[model samples]
Target: MSYLTLFLTAFAAATLLPAYSEILLGTLASQDYPLFWLWFWATAGNTLGSVVNGIIGRQVDRFKDRRWFPVSETQLHKARNRFNRYGQWSLLLGWLPIGGDALTLVGGIMRVPWLNFVILVAIGKGLRYAFVIWVVLKAGAMAT
Candidate 1:
């Protein structure tokens, strides 16, 4: 049940839901759940969630003229320019809540080499979960 909750929460957060998966993961990790399963589930859920984001982002080209799409190619390319300027290394920090998924979604919009995007996104999101695990274990409140 806990794993399922974690998976769903992380998955939703990765999508544009404005949820905080790291907070959820931190809460769970503080509980001292099996480390392996916890990280595995979180990483799997986050990666799959990002893939969904990429898929949704791919649809943006079809609606580039819409104002409510949240992320359009015009905006995406501008972001891509930033990413390109910063180099793919920016994806490492892609796990940061502020501009994380935006990078991934923009990567999809820019048609970033598919393999590169997947590799970078997985690494970025993976490290984010790892960091959350570290935080929950190190300082997050323990679950009762």
Candidate 2:
């Protein structure tokens, strides 16, 4: 289903990996997919992926020895401090690459309330999908 594809793409994109969710969204939109379902699926998938990052961040101590990540405890502490104070504003630009997932994990590390994090993340994710849908729909409308 188109929703499945969108969800998968969005999920992968939200993780620490490269994915083309925007392309998938554009293709689905061009094919006249059910907008609401498509939007819901994408937002849910992306948000879940971000949550995974949060889970990992909560256990950040385990990864403190890793060379690849290289994020020191002191730095993480500083980040968490800043994150806890400005979590909502951080969610506002969740569409930006890299920052989105990082913010999510940092939020968990900063002990952001679960409900507030999810709600703000949903709003940000919803707007992202809506923008994608609007752009694809507009392009299709102009083409036709």
Candidate 3:
């Protein structure tokens, strides 16, 4: 697949959606696609996806206190408490599996500064893609 396809996959994977861009990245890398472009596209797409999650979190914050809101008041309170305890540094985990999406969302809900959010998310996602690419290249070298 092309880099654009990889980009889209990475974008969707970064969101709450059930997609796995890493697998696609590995497949393409194994096919000898340029590592730099693959890494760049995947990181860009994933970071943008996290930004979207943050924006959604911001919107959800507006309704979190409503009686009919999906999240219970207690849940919101607990989440806020955790955010307070962990502080903004937790956003660096936005590259993790499973919970990364939630972390990005919570970053938004807690009103993390947009600039900080983007920088942290970018760093996290970039490192993740870089690691994946590194592994792919290392394995390829071993195979050859």
Candidate 4:
């Protein structure tokens, strides 16, 4: 049940949702739940959520011209330009905060290859979880 909760939390966090899964991940890691599984589930959930964002990005282009559209033309253009300048490697930064989610969305809008998107997203998110877990464990050791 705890693992499931963490997985769901991570998934939601990866989406445009404002939730933060790292807190839960740190709590669970400190509790001594298997670190490998915790990291795996969190990365999997987060990556899947990003995929959803990409899918939404792909569909949103149709509605993007509307005045009330969530993402303005300027924002979208900037994201596109950044992605172009940085190339697919920019996807590696998808684990970041505000900018991370935007990059995933831009990838979809730009029709980035799904294979590259998944691989890079998974790697980035996985490394993030790994770092979080490491920090939690290190802190625990220090408190002893």
Task: Please state every model's RMSD to the true fold in angstroms.
Answer: 3.1, 2.1, 1.5, 1.1
> Which pairs of residues collide in candidate 1?
none
Ranking according to lDDT, highest score first: 4, 3, 2, 1
- Highest TM-score model number: 4
Q: What is the C-alpha lDDT of each candidate?
A: 0.75, 0.78, 0.90, 0.91
Provide the lowest-lDDT 10-residue window in model 2: 86-95
lDDT, candidate 2, equals: 0.78
Candidate 3, residue 49: the lDDT equals: 93
Q: Residue-wise lDDT of candidate 4 within 1-144, one digit each (tens)?
A: 988898899999989888899999999999858999999999999999999989998988799888888777888788888889988788889999878998898889888899999999999999999999999999999999
Question: Residue by residue across 66-107, what tens digits does model 3's lDDT show?
Answer: 878888878878887888898889998999997899899889
lDDT of 2 by residue, 8-28 (tens): 889888788899788887777
- lDDT value, residue 61 of candidate 4: 78
Question: In model 4, which runs have C-alpha deviations exceeding 4 angstroms?
Answer: none
Q: What local lDDT does model 3 show for residue 115? A: 94
Clashes of 2: 0
Worst 10 residues of 4 by lDDT: 70-79
